[model samples]
Target chain A: MLSHQLMAGLGLSILWINALLIAGAALRELAALRARRARLAGPLLRGRVEQGLGPDRAFATHTVEQVGRAADVRSGIAIHFSDRAYRSTIHGGTLALADGSRHTVPPSDDARSEVWIAPTEADAPPGDAALERAWSEAKQSRGFARSLDRSIREQATIAVALPREEGEATWVFDERFARDWLARREGLAALFIVLELAALAGATAVCFVGGSFESVVTKVGGALCVAWFLGVQPIGVALSEACRPLHRAPVRGAWRRP
Target chain B: MSAGTATHNAESRIFKHPAEMRQFGLVLTYLALLFAMVFVPATRTLPCLALACALSFLNTVVIHNHLHQGMFRSHSLNLAWRCVLSFGALYPASANIPSHNLVHHHFEDEGQPDWAAPERVGFKWHLLNLLHFPNVAGPHTFNGVTRWAALYGREDFRRQYTREMVFAFGLTGALLLVDFWATLFFVLIPQLYGARCILRINLIQHDGCDTTSDYNHSRNFVGRLFNWVMCNNGYHTIHHNRAGLHWSDLAKEHEREVLPRIDPSLDEPSMALYLLRTFVLRFTRPVARAVALAEQRASVPASDLASRAERRQSIEAELRAAP
Candidate 1:
């Protein structure tokens, strides 16, 4: 029946769509974990730089990490610290502090990565809906490009230039935003776990269930399960990227001498 | 006239390039095979259905190319061909104009997001990105198409789009009425699969690429067989840089212009290797794309049918200008 076919497609779409959303949520969680990882850190225990900087170790270490994110540290991201905050430019062992003084930093990758937030005047992207009318009305009142250019150009101050996106990866703010962010993220983490469980359970059942399932359904479901398993292999890469190596952590790095 | 010259002349009259015959043939094969399954139930095997699904996916690609640069020289034939392509993919082919050609080609240029940007999914696993990308992208494309048509679309554009859409769905409806089982298995599955694959192409080609750079904006799959089967879509960096270039000329254009200027990492020897590395073995992670926060930040790309020589000169200028 057409109804049966449509129903099957609908069922498949609903299942797959939820699966995708869950995967997206996991990505966001890792981003949040990373952001949390970037916050204030303890002074390096007894490293050369830690010993050299003495009491200024923690502040310098934290600032350096944040500054790296703002510059060309990552493949594509460049999230410079806000104007008020101190930033640095790393040149191998030497660090050029934002304040103009330079310091020699260690070779280890142990600094915390600051989250990138859009500036005050940054307007969120236009919603994807009924664009024709919105465009027409806007065009009637003022040229679309001209209006947008005027609006953004009119801003009194711009903090970040072109940055990446929102959510865990970039959405910037201070520790005050951290509590609410944590609360919301805790719910998301819970959701992520639940979704993972459900996906595993569903895929397992779909793959292993016997003759009760229509043979065609069994074949299609099994294919989806296998394919999905293949898809998640990058989870390893994502995990490797997100999880800081315990051995190389700032505290551990700081404790050791070069 | 000699038979060879007569045939060549006739072919030229029908198609802008003789190569489009292959695309037209594949579209026919998909439709013919679907009907064969419907009428000749014995022919409806798993392999046959799978072939249908493959052809159906190819149909979407063919339609995408057709939408970009019409294969037929005759305007009427081009419009009629869209109906055939639409029926094969089970959606109006014109939708690609707004969703892919306008929005995607611009690639979040002018502060608008590519509706199908991989960041939309940002799946933990690479494979999941491909699998689930279509679910998000499909709706966005259609919605964008509808909204675009309502605002900027012309009378002919709206009429033609409506006609193509009605032909696709109307024919599918008629098929369902004739034999629901055949329509479901033989037609719908393949159509849906094709639609999904086409949607995945954006993420596959552009994901993790430096959309900001002059040369690194897209990943290119350079496998000869892959390009042959996919009508040279594997050379995506060149395609985006030169949207109006014919599919047949893409390989040569990519070699001469894109291969030199583009980051070597953007070029892949095999799409199969890419799919395995990206979606299966999961070697690469999504490169966090850096786009401007403020609206209207993007510089406009060149006008349509941009010369490859012009792009090369631009790349050279940027390189020379770079500190």
Candidate 2:
């Protein structure tokens, strides 16, 4: 019964480790994709902005118009900001709806911001209320966009925002900073592997020297393996006051001093 | 400013490569012995298995040393050592390496905990976890027959189901075909007691140690003879301080720095006795505050444990310094 139990546990440990290995593989894959996307798209966007096709203009001509046509909406513009230091992005453009009202609005700087166009009835009051609303909406959108843009440029912050509901925007902080901010995020799983092996080695020593069985259980039960990776492991990496760059960007030069 | 930078640079020489030949040989020999324990079968496979189990546990501790290569920076050798140690069947090397080297080393016990606590964990709730099934909130019951039957239900468990089933069946089948009493006494009962003992010792190590002093929280049973047999792991404080450092160098560095600092009076009691006493004392008066206060007095390496300086500062600041 006892050997059976221990054997059963050993088997379980194998499976658990394999699952963790897969999860680590996935994280590495995602990080690679993100890095690749950044590498490929970064230069092209920078080129366009430098050519005086300001992000807003370039997006209006290239990106947003295509999106508008694909979605069966009116014209749209994507405002691109050149500063990588700044994290905010703003989009401003006009939207034509099924209704005849041409809502010329500056949408928020956020990538997901949207401007909704509603039809004005022929029997509507002939005041400039529709135009005023459009202007007001544009003003609000621009303000938020500019603020986000400023925030991104000023700090090493990660965020995503999109317009949602009426007059409200949804913002998401990049909590996946652990994966992005650290150089060894992908290597975390590999580190865990080494730790487990060392722990097993240590347990054997304890057992050989003192006949300690608890060392075996603690080493093999997979709890310490779980705890180190989930709790202590990530904490050590995150809390360390070191910013290890994943790649050498000689072209980028030293980051501008704070 | 550039001169200041140069001066700072002079003080620290960053390594493009790191390696250690002596540590590598030690680790290689240790692993060879571990393999022998598993396959030699001198006393019987059961004793051999127990020996393997114990070695595998110790291997986990050594894994910490291997990652840092702090004591032995022979980059090529450590890399090879890492590869071999990680590939062991007893414990998957890849899983622990990344989790410990990258995640646990980075996270410790707080922040993003990918390795420590379970998604859900508790003794009362853990019976479900044993079968690899996480319990949702509901009334659940188990009787002797049902519990026994549940063991055979492999579908519910994603990872260990097939592996455990095969091992159990294979062991039982081999035993029934051979000497039943021998299997019962050697394989069944002794192994069970061994596992139970392992858990008790593990729990006692950190159970009532001063949380404030991270070093004290995880007590070290130090002795050259004992440590040498266990890959120099009795130097818990030094190991935690320089995790990537190898086991052999851990003792040397610990003696050079930590030993001279600790009051010799503290040498009278064995770590085992101290931990045991703390465990008993915890039952009557929880050691949390005292431990925390003690931690304020000094530095202890285990991040979960506290330091004496911090403990003492906090106490003096609170109790005496306030004029």
Candidate 3:
């Protein structure tokens, strides 16, 4: 009888594992879609940086975090700015994603104050392969010919509305910051994966042992609270890791001035 | 091209090409092995199980080629063939269309992350990259495939993909139900091995290569007999360059276009030798360079496995720097 039950559970594991694979897969696609749509949802505008706006200006502090140089994190010096919008959004440069919202440059000290406008991809939203391909090519070139910032700007997935002129300040990578941020992202992702596994196990066991309705509901519910408020930020990081173009994110070795 | 090989509209015999016959024979041998494992109890030894796994791994290679160019001319026959191939590797064979052809092959053009880029894994022991890769890649491929099928703007693709999922799982599940222990040990292990090995191929073929260069984009394993066993997968550069070209024709094309321009280091003589040297011996030039750069940073690679508690211990440093 024990053998029979064990065998039954083994069979069920196979079925459930495949079920998880597809479910995990579906979640990933939804996350990538959310990533693309998140920007269009108006920047999650938590902070604003501007030129010498007096104290009490709403700073988008939530959007910017100092991540130490983790394994994948590139080491570079970070410079802090005093302007309200002049965030140290990583000292290399700040990536602004205001589609068709005229990327304003911080007025140049010289007469040649030029700003680069990101091409409008909002109308189509790269829904097809051809457009996605074009966006990918654009990413490859951002570091070469175009003078764009690192991080999101390098991806060219979103336009860096106002480009910063080079030689602004000598930059050095804060490994501590990049590593700190990466560790949090990876740690949170692993935590979320553990939570999902717990939920999967609960769901499987409840079925196997023949659960009462109330007990089943409580077990599964308590096993997973993905939409709940228990751990929202880490969960977001984890899901983002699943879909974000992490492997392609190339960090420059140095942006220090000659 | 379809008329030349396809039997649906021709007076010719089925699968006249030598490569065509080889693929069909291999698939038949795999099915026979599956039968023997369950029925012939004496064949259930360690060597036989390993043989089954190797054969199952080869099944993935066969399906890769078979998916590219259908072995059978008739659509229904091809579908049946696909169901068998899918079960052999424990995945929906149709997934290659999305995970491989659409994404990995079109790496440069797609402008998205190749699901299995080697950089995704960073461990001191390079072998760990091969193991940890599937954890990151499997979800990306399956997830990307779901989106690709829907956004692909084709109803047939959705239908076919769904059918494959059902058939592959249904057959495997039935076998498990028949005898769980036997299937788990004899059959399922081989199936899982095939799936994992196939995923690792992405790491083996592309790691550390200049992905942007036309001819240098992919490393090739050009051993003649090795290519015969691998169905000419060794000639990889030209395969990526001209994806639609049949596997049989890759050798000649590699000789013409790739051999002249490809870096000699990129043209490895054997996949087995390359893997043993790169992952295990650690004497390869790349490994030497990494060791030289961080002779004392043994703790660095392992830091990739960081935890919240471990990080929180450093929170003071984190907070101090966060102005």
Top-scoring candidate (lDDT): 1
Q: Chain B vs. true chain B: TM-score for each candidate?
A: 0.87, 0.46, 0.82
Kindly report the docking quality category of candidate 3.
incorrect
Candidate 3 chain B: worst 10 consecutive residues by lDDT? Answer: B288-297
Identify the CAPRI category of the predicted complex in candidate 2: incorrect
What is the C-alpha DockQ of each candidate? 0.04, 0.01, 0.03
Comparison by lDDT, 1 against 2, better one:
1
- For model 1, residues B142-217, the per-residue Cα lDDT tens digits are 6556545643213466788899989998998798668754666678778878987988888888887767665577
True contacts kept of 2: 0.00
lDDT of 2 by residue, A7-115 (tens): 4355345435434433343344445545533433222111111111225242221111100001111232211111112122334333332343433324344334311
lDDT of each: 0.58, 0.35, 0.53
lDDT, model 2: 0.35
TM-score: the better of candidates 2 and 3:
3
> Docking category for candidate 1?
incorrect
Mark the regions of model 2 whose C-alpha exceeds 4 Å error after superposition: A1-258, B1-42, B45-47, B70-80, B87-89, B102-114, B117-217, B255-286, B292-323
For residues B1-323, write the lDDT of model 3, one tens digit per residue. Answer: 57655643343345535567777777788878887877676777667777888889889998888776677656677777888898898778988866776567655213435766766555546665665556556666775665445431235666777787788889877875665445655787688678878988888887877765556667799999999888998899888776657899999988877776667777899888998888888833253112122213323232222332333224223322320
